[model samples]
Target: MHLAFLRDYHEALVIALARTRPTIERGTVAEITSLTPQAVSKVLTRLLDDGVIATAGVRRAALGKPAAVYRLVPESRWAIGAHVTRRALRLVLTDLAGTVHASATTALPADFTPDDLLGRLDSGVTAMIREHRLDDDGPRPLIGVGIGMVGPLDQATGTVRDAHRLRHWHDIPLAELAGQRLGRPVLVDKDVTAAVTAEAWRRDAGFRDAALIMVESGVGAGLWLNGAAHRGTHTNAGEFGHTVIQLDGPACACGRRGCLEAVHDRAADPAAAAAILGVGVVNLLQTLDLGHIVLAGADLLRHGEIYRQVVEDAVRTQVPRADWLTAEVTLTGLGTDVIAAGAAIQVLNLRYGLPDPVGLRLP
Candidate 1:
């Protein structure tokens, strides 16, 4: 059983080591993965046989002996990720190790239907796969399709509950529909939640616990806790942008008045949402006590400094117990590509049979 656990961790380690520096020696992999030298060699042999890795070259190290380096082969299977936002659909294709290979974005027509979107997404993936010459039907290179969409999704039914922008999109079967068209299994999730899942396994800061708040065309958040992403009951727990802030403020497109989205039109312009988002975000800071709220998406990053200042001020004012809620509300390092990168991460995770982020129900 212990070896079983190490077995999974070992595959992930080899992929990680091969990616970090493009090439790695056996001794270096041992240090990074914390596995013994002999154990690392055993794993390397298995990986090479699987065609996931290949030997780069041998280098003389000052410590003990010379070591052979390993690199990721260019042709190990791939996973496809799709992001359907208000006006456009973004696509990302990546390898088993979650490294992106090709990406494309297409504008979505205003009078589009669920069927229309599915067709476009399917064709996009097909064209991209063929263009990249990555199809061989060897072992199912395409793991699955992951979608990052605007939400209030019913996980059980895989339906889109009322969306502000996608008024025509309601209770539509996304995963099954897309799956039928693409000939693969599909995972549909909120865009922000996907972002949270993508960012949690950061090799840099290594923040295992954090919250990702995105003030975009809509506002939402993805929470990461205990090395897992947290989704609440109904899978829409992080719907903060829609929470009512003003009962009599402005009529939201969703038919609500003074809601976080009503006053904050971050989608219209990110600078606008900063004020309204700050009001409630401060309250959440003191309540969750979890540090590191990530401000991502197109809108928030547009007026990043303003959003940062407003949230920071609110934290200082509301969380009187601390100077700044004891957390850092920041931006995502991935920029616009996050949606695709995150989706790719989801694809790899599902392939490896890893646990879904905490709080997300497995429907």
Candidate 2:
């Protein structure tokens, strides 16, 4: 119960801070949350005492008493993020202020098994910890970990249900294996989902409800809402690649004709701007009602203009809903390295705590 309540209160505090930027009066926080002024005062006091927030100065209304304002301390704790792909793995340790502290990567064989991947992950974590100069011993009581990997992921089971990029891979035990080995809570998300998570956490444009679409080696999308990934009933909500976009477009490996994946084949179609892309984007955007679109992943970037033009053109023509027009589309901030940054950031988060300036307390 304490844990649950702490999490809820933490979220409430985080939401309030995010919406208002750095500094806010206790009264203002109360007004935004519709909570009693006294309650807000208590939370603020705790935040200040714990160093999560700090008092800045006195604010004076035209004819009122001076006000004490609180702001996110700017640096509190930090997080590690990791992104895993068929060819390589990337990791980064970040400070609470969205600053990258350390980073590294290693090549991954296309035929590696789940066990093989986990072994590399263990080695990577140990190396990252050492590189980060984590305390005299190591990190303890970490925040959380977020992982980005090739999907169809079973979030509940922490398994990769089926990944085409890796040879003979299905139902790979990723979450359980990593969590057990690392001794920290692990969050499993598809590459796009983890990218969205990182994007939201690091940027002002992050959606209260949003979607991230990656057209890389494999086309996949990730869904995030209310500051967390919406893994859905079956935890397979964003498998848009499997949805049929063009009934007779092309044959998919799933033994289907015209699935989004087949239509958006990055390698075969040098020109990714064919009619098939329009159908997929239009169908996906309308159904998701997402307010923003982050176009990322390596394959799409490789094609560059071809990829963007197809998506933008499709969105313009297919989306009849006026509200959908406002959905902002932008290239990922980190571009092709987003997954790697996201992955490394996830590990850092586990070591430090999301946005906690205290990061891993490297010796």
Candidate 3:
């Protein structure tokens, strides 16, 4: 590895620690990151000088010299995340620590077009910036914008290859278009991927090998494996809704018959729908051997407890040797804000979080 890249990784690791840990010090950070004391000292000094972190006073040890504690200066930078749902656009402004400081939502037109979305995005983002008084020239400037939209889209090129159920979205260059309109750097990703990223950020190292199942306008699963968001070969991984569950089932928007989403959506009641969802989740667990399953999305949250119970029951009863193949299931604590907040956190991750270890194998 290049020395410069290694230095960048060390800095990102330290920043990640400061974001998640309540208190940070040289000894603990070095211990956790496996960086030598001297390297840790250099990283800390640089971060401190850059105003990304600040001293939180001192921690005294009876045997050794008192070590200075540090904490992330969350307000030093900010990013806006937008969740582009079928009915509305949900926006959240988050800080470097990934804490959502403010949120807003605006309704979209029926079967909205790229122009429609771009217009709304421009007005909405401008309003947010003005309302929050987030001066571009201020000490704490807004970093960028991130959009979490329904997908089967291309994350690598920031283009929508073909967003299921939305006609105008095909072949749209969302990231570039939004960036041009908003006058800020932009990132576009599947909504489920964004939601899972938010959960991973919140859970820290404990979030390894997990999936975030979302059920709003449709069903999809966001995958986080080996400590990172798994955006498969085409960067279009989270199309969990279209997975075939029934051979003679109803037709789906993706031109598939008996897809999980189609079957679940046709169910009579919330309980029935949830039960259908549970089966798919168990299938996911069986395939991935996931340790955590987080449930989110507005439609699902309306009957959150019912879905949670159904999914938990499925996990307990369906998978073989349930005792050994246990998976914790729960609703996303962020409620409807999960995807939007995750979008903003994605921007933070790009700017100040850990570098992706793409080809490295993990234990």
Candidate 3's C-alpha runs over 4 A off are: 358-363
TM-score of 2: 0.82
Query: Could you estimate the TM-score for every candidate?
Result: 0.81, 0.82, 0.96
lDDT of each: 0.73, 0.65, 0.89
**In candidate 2, what are the lDDT values of residues 308-339, reduced to their tens digit?**
67766667767896453556666777766677
Candidate 1: minimum summed lDDT over ten consecutive residues — where? 353-362
Clashes of 3: 0
Query: How well is each residue in 213-260 modelled by candidate 1, as lDDT tens digits?
Result: 886677778877666666667767687877787777877776778778
- Model 3 per-residue lDDT tens digits across residues 1-363: 699888888999998888788989999998999999999999999998888999999988998899999998988888899999888898999888778899999999988999999999899889999888887758868888899998878888789888777878889988889888887778888899989989988777888999999999899999999998899888888888889999999999888899999999999999999999999999999999999999999999999999999999999999999999999999998999999999988887776767754421110
Q: How many pairs of residues collide in model 1?
A: 1
Ranking by lDDT: 3, 1, 2
Q: What range of 10 consecutive residues in model 2 has the weakest lDDT sum?
A: 354-363
Q: Summing lDDT over every window of 10 consecutive residues in candidate 3, give the lowest-scoring window.
A: 354-363
